[model samples]
Target: MPRIPLVDVKAQYAPLLPELKQRIAEVLEEGTFVLGPNVAAFEREAADYLGVPETIGVGNGTDAIVLVLNALEIGRGDEVICPAFTFYATAEAIVRTGATPVFADIDAATLNLDPADVAERITPRTKAIMPVHLFGRPAPLAELSKLGLPLIEDAAQAFGSPAVARAGVASTFSFYPTKNLFAIGDGGLVAVTDPELGERVRMLRFHGSRDKVTFEYVGTNSRLDELQAAALRLFLPRLDGWNAARREAVGRYAELGLGELCDLPTDEPGHVYHLCVARSAERDRLRAALTEAGIGSAQYYLPPLHLQPALRYLGYREGDLPETERAAAENFSVPLWAGIGAEQQERVVQVIRAAARVPAAS
Candidate 1:
């Protein structure tokens, strides 16, 4: 069997080659490399697709989160409550803003932030709650909305997910090469429901420039380039179909009954499966087995953020987040891309099943 990649970017690109080539040629001809017409066009299209008034393109997802925090004035001594089970970027963004990350446990079933636990973690210093839609599933938006705290959605894995309007704040998306609605390289965007907040993000992404040459505030250099934006324009319309295919694949995997041995990925109405993950008692072993069988499986987050060495200053200790710790040890993600074929999926399923049936001693 051929080695199956976790994401077949090449396969996806093959079909879009002609259009991609045309877009790149246009960019090259115009010589507008930075935030130009293409970038603006993509932002508008993305905003419409996400059902938001504005979407500001940025350098990457991490920057998107940091910019939002900065715009919200969530700096020194502020406590940002977030689940420790998500990617390091979520917690890292909080720390980057000079704010403290108050770790909360995740729901075992959804692998998302537990709203009850999040509410419990909130103190007077709590300025915001950043809920990550991990692997492609939407976080418990409805439950989290009742708190009335600022909600910065770490929607890096959920670009095309069904929109769940939160009461307090904005949602951030990543267009990293591996994301569901990816760009050629590093890219990100922010969707702000609040007009004033959205305007602030636009300025923050471009060196806090209120005017052409006047810098109003301290800001970072993080703007999405024109070439990537153009590519995204070519790809945006296909997002729904791609997401639908992922859903179909998820259904097939579930029907295979592998969930008996491993906890299958769950959905909540409007999720777009960025990655189809599973929880297993023997996660590490199963991952190794899949690799040996030429199947590419991944561990979404092995070391929960609270347990990371860099986060020691936050005062978190071992067993601080029991649910997060449990998930970090057992969760693994499998290939679920737009270009995945039926044969490849079947082979992946077969290998995983075979791996699961093997005894640990062997």
Candidate 2:
């Protein structure tokens, strides 16, 4: 087997090289760089694609979350219920806003924030619920909506997934090179149905000024660069097709009986399959076998966010969140980028099967 990467962005980008070069040339020739025509154009296109009225592009995904919270007026001593199993940025945004980030447990099935756990954590201080669509599947918006608090979707991994953007008060997207819809460098977008909130993000991204000289609020300079926007425009048209390809690769894993060897993700329509993850008590051994076979694998997260030392002040212990703790320990993602071939997939399964001798817990 040849060497595989956990995410082969080069494989996904190669076929579109000519178009990327052309678009990048146009941006250079125009010279209207920061938040220029290309940036505005991508915002309009992304808004249409996601079924939201507006999309405000930002410097990166982390800033997108911060912009959304600031617009909502959530700060200082307030609480935001966020899942403990996600990237630190979700909770970090809250901390930066001076709000307490109350960590919630995740559902073992979807590896998403558990609604019941979320309800248990809610208090008068709770301002919003940020349900992360972890590993490219939508979280339970229906149940979360019933809680009567606004929802902010951390959709960094769910860019092309169906109905994910439509579920929350505001949905955030990351265009880091690995995401389904991405740029050559880091970029982000915040989509919202409400024009007022959309305008708020627009102002918040550029030092809180509606006009160039007037500073209306305490905001940061975090606009998306026109070059990255132009590059992303090249891939926007092919996003669904690429997402379909990832889904197909995941199906091949099921067909090869990899599920019996480890815990597999569900084949849900809303899932864009960012990472073809599975759980195993033998996860470490399996990763070693894949490495020896020149097949790549990664632990999506080894320690859930609540237990991370940075958030130790949150006062959580080892057993505070049982499911989140277990997920961090047992789960790891396998190689399944959009352009991966069946032969590469077969090698991944073969290596795992060889390593999964003991019966794994479901």
**Candidate 2, residue 77: how far the Cα is off, in Å:** 1.0
Clashing pairs in 1: none
lDDT of 2 by residue, 1-362 (tens): 46988889999999989988998898889988899999999999999889889999999999999999999999998999999888889998889999999989999989999999999999999999999999898899899999999999999989988769786889999999988888999999999978899999999999999998999999999999999999888899999999999999999988988899998898776899888889988999999998898877888665888888988998989999999999999888999899888888888888898889876555
Quote model 2's TM-score.
0.98
Candidate 1 local Cα displacement, residue 135, angstroms: 0.9
TM-score of each: 0.96, 0.98
Off by over 4 Å in 2: 360-362
Candidate 1: list runs displaced more than 4 Å.
164-168, 358-362
The top-ranked prediction according to lDDT is: 2
